[model samples]
Target: MSLHPMCGVFVLLSICLISFTTPCYGGNILVFPVDGSHWINMKVLVEELHARGHNITVVRSSNSWYIAEKSPLYTSFTVQIKENLEEFFGKYLKNHLKMEREGASALTFLKLTKDFISMVSEGHFLWCEAISEIFDDPNRVKSLIDAQYDLVLTDPAVSAGVVLAKYLKLPLVLNVRWIPSGEGHFAVAPSPLSYIPVPGSGLTDKMDFMQRIKNLFFHSIIVLQQKFVVGPHYNALCDKYIEGGCDVFSLLQEADIWLFRSDFVFDFPRPTMPNIVYIGGFQCKPAQPLPADLEQFVQSAGEHGVIIMTLGTLVNALPAEVAEEIASVFAKMPQKVIWRHKGERPSTLGNNTLIVDWMPQKDLLGHPQTKVFVAHGGTNGVQEAIYHGVPVLGIPLFFDQYDNLLRLQERGAGKIILLADVNSQTFEQALKEVLHQESYRQNIERLSRLHRDQPIAPMDRAVFWVEYVMRHKGAPHLCTEAYKMPWYSYYCVDVMVFLLSAAAVLLLSTLAIFRFLCCSRKRKTKDKQH
Candidate 1:
């Protein structure tokens, strides 16, 4: 039965309306990062999303892998350096050394290095430039969106992708890598560590008087150095990438949802904006059996069991002194120690100490012989530890590590030691306390149960929300309206109350002046008549 032309037109109109109104299969997510910490979560999310029948295309940043692949010797050297350091630290600091705390310091050193490296080298800047170029290209993003799929989910690292989303005028979901950028303000209302100061405080209360001055001096130096030393190089890189101006921060504000890879187990600030959602600890899965070698090592160590120490991926290297301190502590401990380091150790290792450059941390943590985690307190590490119901001795280095570990201690899931003065004795004491204390283990167990009891795994929740965006016309409901208003309007005190108050003051001042002038003239006339 061939349809008439009129009937065909009606059928076509119906299809168009359904396409507009009905939900799409949850659209493709463009995740960045070649292969590192993001690999675990990103893989889990993409796989789970696919399982739920959503299409996903991950455009990995091949930068790190490329470097390693190109320079095998360098990579090996890096690994050797790490392993040596782990051995040294484990053997020396075994007395009472806080492995996690030292781990934190190591992390800070790495971050400090990254800051300097980014300044000295052109690699990261060049990558940014390349991204900017792609964004600046005409209709590149629009073409991609039009070719297939409905919304775009991006990590904040892809500042260029944010711009692309803006250009395409599509809904965007920001998959928060760890802590949201401005979460210090959100998590702790009166946070003193203000990178971007809140208004009226004059950037004064943002830091102590000395720190503020130091920051100013440091910023001035950086700006001057950039102008003289780094700016030209960066500009060359920028020239290669960005054609037109773009605001990366603005793109963050424009995102439809800021989905955090965290749970209430860590930092649970009451949500100020509807768009922010905490879905942390989602990547942690139930424990699987350890490999034969690791299992054998644990078995050989006997009844006291072993402590697992890792500083996470970024801070594989440690200072020699710190490394030695860790090694010294491990030498004194009766229990076996497994340390992950990336340097050469000067000290001799005891039979109880196992120093390796890398360990399957989750797998090790899940081991029945594993008692405590000595860590740098990265969210990923913390979550994994918690999920395994293991307590941590957190040595926070910098960034959110301090805050993250602090919260852990507060939650009774872990304890913290200052990174500045950590030695074998202190590290050992902290470790002994963590291992012996029943509360630490019990507290973590409670957190672990709560973490596992979530209605669905984090991946499922993440995928569901992503799909929800497509089903509900870009998840308009998830978007926050806070950015739409001026800062004053957000509190309903700026334009509304402030203007009203100003008007009242002006009217009162005018009336008073008029009355005063009238009285003065009347008094002068009366004097003249007299």
Candidate 2:
């Protein structure tokens, strides 16, 4: 009878634990996502949210590149766009690559800056226009207001999501790495220019005097760009729709939680906020079995191991010459190579290499036989490499790609070969170094161990916060009110000024008293002598 009672108690405890541990409650969530490679990151979260039984509705552009109008993951809400940016993006990337390859002359630098500003300004305006169209339609506005969503989940790289969340007055959650201004931290946390490098400055955390100056210059440019190039469009939207006008940066700060996509393993240690959840490698999971044919190819590598290369989703292939050079270098190697190239086939491609439109990147990285990963230094690729303990041989193309690789290089986990500096000789040499060096693998594996040592998986932690926001409606207590303070107040400049004035007044008063006492003593001594 005693044993039976104990067993019943154990069973009851188990049931209660199971109920609390899993996601059992369903809430309605509205997600506004950015298009392009960013959608890939957002989709992972959406899928996880759906599996937990939350009803999801995604707002998408009519000509969205990666997002499908129809999906099993979520119901799609399509909005019209003035232009599909694919053509614009393709041309812009090609031109940018051409300029970069031309070298870092003053003229080249100016042109690149001009092109970048144009892209940023135009992209934001188009999104603002799309959102404006949505607001203009009474039925659409009524539908959204009636939805009674638990929260608005969005990626803030584009301000559409941020602005929409503000308009809806829903509890906001951000899937963020970059905002329209620059890196997300600049808008939310304390980032000292001396140590915290500005994105695209290509400087690391440790900097000499000149490097610090460069970091500051880049930071200024980003500020100017946000104020002049990107801010006006969103500011207009806010003025028109919001009861009180808001700025993009302010709205981002108001978010209940920020699912930061980076961690110390792949990024420099910087000041982070309480609401900022570091879910760096949340998208990564253990490798699954490769497709039968792909596995056969990987297995054939045997002693030499395999090399996997992909330039991410944006570019189809390198310029023909660059592609040919990279292909030729691969040909000379004994290791089998898998290159994801979507453009014209390179004539120099070797029998050892397999060219495909896409490969199972995370799976390939996790494969034990995989020796080296050649990548574009994208955030996804870098984080995946860390998860799989694969040493990277990075060829950075554009936009923070170099910065991402630099982090790995600094830690001795990877090496970077600038796209402008690539040739068969240099490419082959870098490849050989990464392949033969054991330290690279050892260092990355160390990172992998550290990343995995956490008590809870990053994905579970991410889901918890999302649900926490749903349950609580918002997490205002965790957020700092620092964003609302004026620059002088935030920096304590006014306090410093007041303290200095008080010290000056005290010093002057003491000096006057000392002079008065000396004069009095002289007069008394003269009278005594008389």
Tell me, by lDDT, which candidate is best: 2
Prediction 2 TM-score vs. true: 0.95
Please identify model 2 stretches exceeding 4 Å from their true place: 1-23, 519-530
lDDT of 1: 0.63
Candidate 1: lDDT of 289? 80
The alpha-carbon deviation from the true structure for residue 411 of candidate 2, after best TM-score superposition, in angstroms, is 0.9
In model 1, the worst 10-residue window by lDDT is 73-82
TM-score, candidate number 1:
0.70
Candidate 1 lDDT by residue in tens digits, 232-334: 5434433444455433444466677767777666654333456666678777776788779888888877888888888887666566677788778777888
Candidate 1: list runs displaced more than 4 Å.
1-27, 33-35, 66-124, 135-146, 177-246, 491-493, 496-530
Tens-place lDDT per residue, model 2, 1-530, is 25788899999999999888864669999999998889999999999999999999999998888899999999998988887778877888988788767666788788777876887788889999999989999999999989888999999988888898888898999988999888999998999998999999998889999999999999998999889899899999999999878877788888999999998878899998999999999999999999999999999999999999999999888888889999999999999999999988999999999999999999999999999999999999999999999999999999889999999999999999988889999999999999999999999999999899998888888889999999999999989999989999999999999999999999999999999999999999999999
The TM-score values for the models, in the order shown, are 0.70, 0.95
